[model samples]
Target: MRPATVFLLSALIIGSLEAKPNIKNFFSKHFFKDVYGTIDANIKVGDAGKPLILTDLIQQDQIDEAQAAAEVKLDAFLGVKSYAGYLTVDEIYDSNLFFWFFPSQSNFEKDPVILWLQGGPGSPSEYGLFNENGPFFIKDNKLVLRNSSWTTSNSVLYIDQPAGTGFSFTNGGYAENQTKVGEDLYKAIYQFFQLFPNLQPNEFFIAGESYAGKYIPAAAYTILKKNPSDEIKINLKGLAIGNGLTDPKYQVMYADYLIQHGFIDPKSRDALKDFEKQVVESMNNEDWDQASNQIDVELNTINGLTGLSSLYNYLENYSDESDDGIGNLLSREDVRRAIHVGNTDYGDSAVYSYLSSDIPKSVAPLVAELLEHYRILIFNGQLDIMVAYPMTVDYLQNLDFVSAEEYKNAERRKWRYGSDVAGYIKSAGNLTEVLVRNAGHMVPADQPEWALDLINKFTKNNL
Candidate 1:
């Protein structure tokens, strides 16, 4: 269980006497800055009692147990190094963020480093690790090697960020917006590279899904802005977002999506059209709170009638039973101790905290800014209603960037995985978008082989 003080601190920062605080309000941004200044004089160091850095907070980097439990071939672990531990972010409040690193199976020195963040703004990247593209998957009652995992050729780093996320914990106040989340992650990555210097020279990419759409661009922008010199650079190569919610206005194409898919009756579509109109009006008037609430009400109404099937994926039956099992596995005394979680509970708090904040500003501008130098891959599953593929294209088509015309006019090539048609890719210059067929919001899990191929292509700068 989390301490009462943590909630108290969070409330003080986010829940002021003001009703519906605007994200642009000045008070919140500088509240911590004023109190802590640029640096805190009373800050505490790591367990070694040395000056704080990324490596100091590392409690464990053992590959033996996790590899043995994963049942991977001995040769696989020979080149790969897995590190799991808490990296202290706030010494004054004892905020420690947890991370898991899986070096590439190919070449640690040359393989690209992919930093993977999951959606929910709170979902632990471990879900991506185990269920999506991690080195192992839980089967029967043990960890089993996942053959089509993303770690096959590239080094993957998964961190539970914004604090108070799975395995990661914080006694300090939580971040209230995407900007703050980006700053925190920027610091984490800086410390991450500092801890593992060998990865400094390798190609790196920031990739995620859903809410991470907001996170990836914001963090990438922050990294670029902060590190302008080659003396201490991030070697960032590109970015990838899969079924992401980068632009809510464009991403929420439910009315058209539902009507086209026959998920709603004509009468329901009419009602949805009315609600969407009101949402647009509110958004145009800059009443974000009203716009968000109206959209939420509309979504809930649609979901209430959609039956028990997952909103994320219409084709599959949704069951949260796996999350519980994974939680229980991670919460084990031995597991916690091995990962150096100590007494912190493994759960999701970052989601609620982020959602409770004023609606996230659109990440469109951020992505637009990133397109100047870095390659951007935007892939979406055809069946995803939670940030539909059409919505993603709508926003991308509207982006103001250097090669805008080239990207807009590019021919979409047909892509295949084995004998089946995998997806269609439209690429021009640095920006590309792919529509994965028969998949849903979690594309990697739904189409592992295709997802791997797409990622490998993007990382190699071939797409």
Candidate 2:
């Protein structure tokens, strides 16, 4: 094998716990530029003089001083208590994941803790915070409160994962697969609980969008399998995914979906169908990169033929505007100091590199496993051609879950936000699917009230 390929393989192998330091060092030097920072295993002590942490289910001896010392005051915007900082993923060459958390507005003890992840594999959860369900958004370089933010009823946590997204960074390398990513998250979360033990007992729910469809399941499975038997178990209630790209191979049925919805003519539909056949064939042959390329080509062709606007939401026009104004705000020295991420770049290449790699396949099994222990809420914004509603339905129907048939034939009722018709929901057993109306790929950003309702219901096990 070529030197570069071997180096990547070596890095992957050494990411494991069993790998010796010397071998890890060799790969770190060859593959990753050393990150310039102090390794701070910042562990706060309790009255007993012991590290005030939970069970040793997670290996967190290498916690770095990524914790923000800045006292972030968001009372003017959110009128709620918030925390932002980084937690280093151990033994993996500068793999530090950053997190921003908001305590529940109603009652911290009474409300569930919801962990939100963003897609792109490399995408930062801060986008979800500012652009979606967080307490506030950045508008014209200032904080604007989002009244329907999920934090109204749930303690929300947003994490930038895989060591290179958003505020998170790595000098070693990015995570290559779902399993390793899960390990890093599991450990980081455990350490997060160590810092604030009070939140540990609150019921926990994991949710995300797009690529997070693959991540949420793996991370949840890791928590389930790896939690120390005698230690305090995370009160994991359920999992939710919105417009997620769970089964990429099957979810590539976007062309058929669009055609069914009358976006393309019969001839054009048939042509795209033929192209889709080729894409599926490529996937069957395990040429994932080729299959991805084929889908992109097909989708772009359809967009051209139909004159469709945004793939994220067909009902709207696409705009690359920095209207949100988060970049400028986060880059400010005062803001960084207040948030304790002093001088750290908000978004970086380490994140995108991780997303460019081959994705882990068939997370349906992990979803199935979670169903046995907790309920699963899968929803989509109907207008999202990217990871559209039909694609999510297609994958859910194919899962090997016990009540697949019941769910398939279940009645889809009209879901509501007060008197307004928000969307539709079909549920059976532990699986529930909702078709969010008039929303896009980022449902929370498009329909914040509806999105907040969804979370409140899911976290409470009401839906």
TM-score of each model, paired residue for residue: 0.82, 0.82
Off by over 4 Å in 1: 1-80, 229-231, 358-360
Residue 41, candidate 1: Cα error in Å is 35
lDDT of 1 by residue, 354-433 (tens): 45433424778888889887999999999877778887888888888887899889998999878989999998778989
After superposition, the stretches of candidate 2 with alpha carbons farther than 4 Å from their true spots are 1-71, 74-79, 228-230, 321-324, 357-360
Please give, for residues 2-75, the per-residue lDDT of candidate 2 as tens digits. Answer: 44453344334323313331221222210011111111212122121211121232244322322233135644
lDDT per model vs. reference: 0.69, 0.70
Q: State each model's C-alpha RMSD to the native.
A: 10.2, 11.0
Error of 2 at 300 (Å): 2.6
